[model samples]
Target: MTTPTRRAAQAGSGALLHSLFRTKPVDRIVAEGGQGEGGELKRSMSLLQLTLFSVGATLGTGIFVVLGEAVPRAGPAVVLAFVLAAVTALFSALSYAELAGTIPVSGSSYSYAYATLGELVAWVCGWCLLLEYAVSVSAVAVGWGSYLNEFFDKAFHFTMPAAISDSPGENGGIVNLPAVVVVMIAMVLLLRGTSESAIANTIMVFLKIGVLLFFCAVAFTAFKAGDVTPFAPMGWAGISAAGSKVFFSYIGFDAASTAGEEAKNPRRDLPLAIVLSLAIVTAVYVLVGLAAVGAMHWRRFALSGSEASLARVLDESTGRSWPSMILSLGAVVAIASVVLTVMYGQTRILFAMSRDGLVPPVFQKVSPRRSVPVANTMIVAAFISVLAAMIPLGRLVDATSIGTLFAFALVSVGVMVLRRTRPELPRGFRTPFYPITPLLGVGFCVYLMVGLGGVTWLVFLLWALAGLAAYFLYGRRHSRLAAAPEGGGPPDSGKGAPAAGEGEP
Candidate 1:
């Protein structure tokens, strides 16, 4: 009884829905791990290197600069905010650990979403990851410039001119040259190869940890019980708001998961690295936050600049320039390590998406000699450099937090979906309490996302819209899964197979 026009409309709608929710098989995702353009990604990262990579990425800027910003909002209760953020991150970290052990792919949450959720959700997760990593590197690079200027003033009695050191429109800055310089430096190191970069990150991670401990030792010398009084001055609302803000600090704990294909023992190492790094980072952050608040009144942090908060705290605690100088030096190394590891994570995510034909093929083109994604690294560096040179840090940070929370929420959902759909799959690690843990992860992520500013939500919505446009325009048409025959995998590209030595742990 239906006319041809109505029948055609129904058919078109059905086809669109089918394409939107199509899930990629987990086995296919694993089998396609190392098949890139020129060569496969080399697996050389040990458990120590993987853990250090996450530590290197997570330990920067948030404690160094964001502490100052959060303190005014929550008073001494900023310490509680750090703990709350860590708790939020912990729930999701457990989910990430389970999935990383089971999947063991370079795509991180994006690949997990594809294997469990759908193509549309996978693209959205990947796009959010792009926002999280790229903008976080830019934000960290901006913080690096502040410390670099502090180091210059301390060691040489000189600082770069405001025009060249600050982002556009801040302090009359035309460009943040130091931020650009750091991004380029990270790019060069990434081109060298993953193992070489991890080695450098390990050294920097230890140095920064030493500096933070030194900060705590000196800061405690001036600790007063009075400063920590009235800890909940603004009550639970203020602590929750600050928790959302400080959540930016916890963004990089998943950096280890992005290296799933590159880890020497991904099944065991990825989960261990993820959980260990979060524990280590959380302890350091809580210790530093307590020390900072106890050494000085929370209100005073506003008078001092937030960009170089730790150095200023050290300066005040000791009434000496040398301590601040030491802190500044450590911050420069600390933040640069962040930029390096986060940017590496970004390139690998793009590489995975590219392999699925969701982005340009250049992303998956591994360098034959170095076994790194040279072109992908360069592209990411160039884009991040521009952002660091142009955008203000405050705008960059909140936008990054929202994107990260959204991605984390999706990852939590993915864990539950995979468990229900493929309970028989071998898992090297399993989430404790199963549905309850992942459900709490999703709940915490949503709570924080709601606490973020309305402007950040608007920015995230616009970003999601842009991703949808890109996906429909290019990704949907060229998707490998879409082109495959029914109940079959995509045709082999004949690039290369996964490297030997990968096996269940």
Candidate 2:
């Protein structure tokens, strides 16, 4: 159905915010309960499956593609940059863990903001997350397309048309067919349900980690000490720049955080999942970076789509195409898997927003049989698919990093706000270093944001502003919190008195 008029939405949202947050405990903004009857959206996912979701979502084609871009900037020190990004991610993960423990909601940072900051801020937070998840899936799909082409030519001895393979803006290519196809497939899987996708995602994660491990082993054989001659050839600036670029790889930690509502024992498992995933991914990124740089000159690892960067290294080391073919095949599968998991994350975030009336209600329509938001998944898939098909992989990656960094900055700030306002609220997992850890997270995220080019920042700002406008026009008014009955708020919203939806603390 069409959402409320823009002016009405803004007025409604403003009124709702004033009423919801002004109270002592903010008890006037709970969500409508029994959304899908009694037993919709079954919690069939285990801790291991959830961990795979986070890792699979985060570890996709980014390393395969962006590493080339980052290596030139940091030279040998890009490894250090990966560690810095991981450290920042860890802090954010800690804050996420605490919030998840206390709230255990599906809205992620958006819900957190509503409970602590107010309604308007919560709407904006949700808007920013939209950018992070949707744009990220598009970026990963494009990256996957790049590697797919490379693998096809090297292993199958065939090449697709440039127009079908390359992005429209860059060069003269028309569309990226492979990227678009993968997005469509992911949408279908999401419509069927999460259980199946979780299984597929777990398999994909195994393959990606395995491929990286294999590459590390093989690349090390050709590793030469001379490659480290000018370790800091580009100095700390370059190192920091590379680190900033690589930071995009760690955005998946929140994927784990997003599963708070479904997780069994979110308090303990959420924190563990976030920290462990970050640590493990960091080690993989750093090791892969070291192997790539050591196997060849840091200066010559072309930052663009070098289809055969890994293959060339393998050829140089083993003097054969078989090893290169193996890497190529593994990369193709890994990229596809990343697209699936990341797209799944995007659809879920959209579903949460829609259910709250922050977006179109069409997204909230769950399938009777599958218990999944079929239309929402299809819409997200279509948008990302068109983007992947038409846009250059490199440009899409740049946009993805900006959206994630902005959202991360917001979450870090949210943590501090909660600490001051809701000291009484039970927090199961507090961030260890308090202000220090969160401050560092903010600092690191901002640093990475700056490393992105002027064009990227400009585009991100324009899109975010557009999202805010949309919220004011539509989401703000129709929010269930605004429609909540008197006598405090609703339970799901953390505004009403404790009841069925009010939930157990």
Candidate 3:
């Protein structure tokens, strides 16, 4: 006995629910791989380039800067903390490797979620990635600027004035010029072509590894058995706290997955690159941590002037200023490499989302001559440069870690969901230990997210709410999936037709 008005309202609500929970089919997602608005992404990246891209994005300010903060919390047991954090990262890396192989798309977790968890969840994952990659790059650029100032003071005996070097409101500063400059440089390299950018990152990665080795050599020269006494001074609580702190060091190991469309053999090479890069970064961090504690007592890491702890250790070990200067030079290179690769990850994620019609089509518009998303790169670079240039980004930086952990947790769940939904699908890499590994990944991610405390949780909640608003206002109406026939795949699947304006300028 319902009236026409009531029946219409019920119908509208049903339609909204259907759109929210609709999942993209696996075959359809794969079929649309490189078919963006303009040119396709060139498949030019090899295993080595992909591996170094992750390494370059990951092995930055964490080891160079965060190590000092972590060592003070865990004492000589900081070495154990590094190992523990690596173990946590390993669990999630396994899930990422398996999914990256099975899907082989540029969206990373967002696409994986769309193929398993539904469109609403997929949009949330994509939003989290935006926060994780964009904010992390901006924060790292600010660190790079400080290190550049340190290098200049050490090597050239000249430092830029604080007003121009520091962010606004810090020491009477106006803008962080060096941070802006580094982001712009990374932007230009990205615009040229993906292959050229990969080559540049490879060189920078090797240079930073050599610099870390040089540090270990200098640190070991003054090693003493006395520094090993009283290990784990703060007990298990301290080691756990330090493990949570150092986990940020492992954030960018998934950078390789964002290059799925650009990789020559994504299914095989993506898994290898993700795992290999994590192993290399963990080994380097453990080696440096052991060497740092061996050369100087752990208590000194808590003292004043411990900002540049590794370089400080070098000065103490060699009783010379030259070694510290070399260390500062290495920090400059290490951070800039991170800026380049991470910014690259951010653009590719947007490109994938744009192709799904969840964002502006400009993000998917590639330059035919370069086979790269030129407008997307430029837009992302401009936004990040502004954030790095003007924002202080102090405690707000922790939001990046929370956002990343949330995405990682969703990926782990996606693995389990996909396994149940599509057991017959071929997988280039199977996560060994199956459900146990993915469950542990989810647990570890939650553990880290909780450690970030209440303030970070509040920030994440606000961000999620804003994302939902955007979805309702724009994403829902424009979604390509919604436009497709009911229970069918994407409308343009297998066609791979380029959108209008599809060639070189």
Best by TM-score: 3
1-505: candidate 3 lDDT, tens digit per residue:
5788898999999977878989988878877788787689888899999999999999998898766788889999999999999999998999999888888889998999998899999999999889888888999999888999898988899999988889999998899999999999999999999999999999999999999999999899899878967889889988998998898899999999999888888878889999999999999999999999999988888772545899889988988989999999899999999999999999999999999889989999989999999999999999999999999998888877888998899889999998998876667688889999999999999887777778889989999999999999998888988878884465524334322222111
lDDT of 1 at 140: 84
lDDT of 1 at 366: 93
lDDT of 1 by residue, 247-296 (tens): 77888899999998898878888999999999999899889989999999
lDDT of 3: 0.89
TM of each candidate vs. truth: 0.94, 0.87, 0.95
Higher-scoring candidate on lDDT, 2 or 3: 3
**Greater-lDDT candidate between 1 and 2:** 1
User: Per-residue lDDT of 1-505 in model 2, one digit per residue for the tens?
Assistant: 4456877889999866585452212332222321432234545566687777778777876677667778788887878889877876887787777776666556677767766766666766677677767676777677666677767877788878877877797657888888888888777776777788878888878887998889889999989989967888889888777776677777777777666545555555656666777777888898988898898877777733355566666777788887777787777777777778767666666666776677887876777788666777788888888777876556645675677777677777778887887666655578888899888878877877787788888878787789778877887667666665641343434334321322243
Question: Ranking under TM-score, best-scoring first?
Answer: 3, 1, 2
Give me candidate 2's TM-score against the actual structure. 0.87
Clashes counted in candidate 3 amount to 0
List of clashing residue pairs for candidate 1 = none
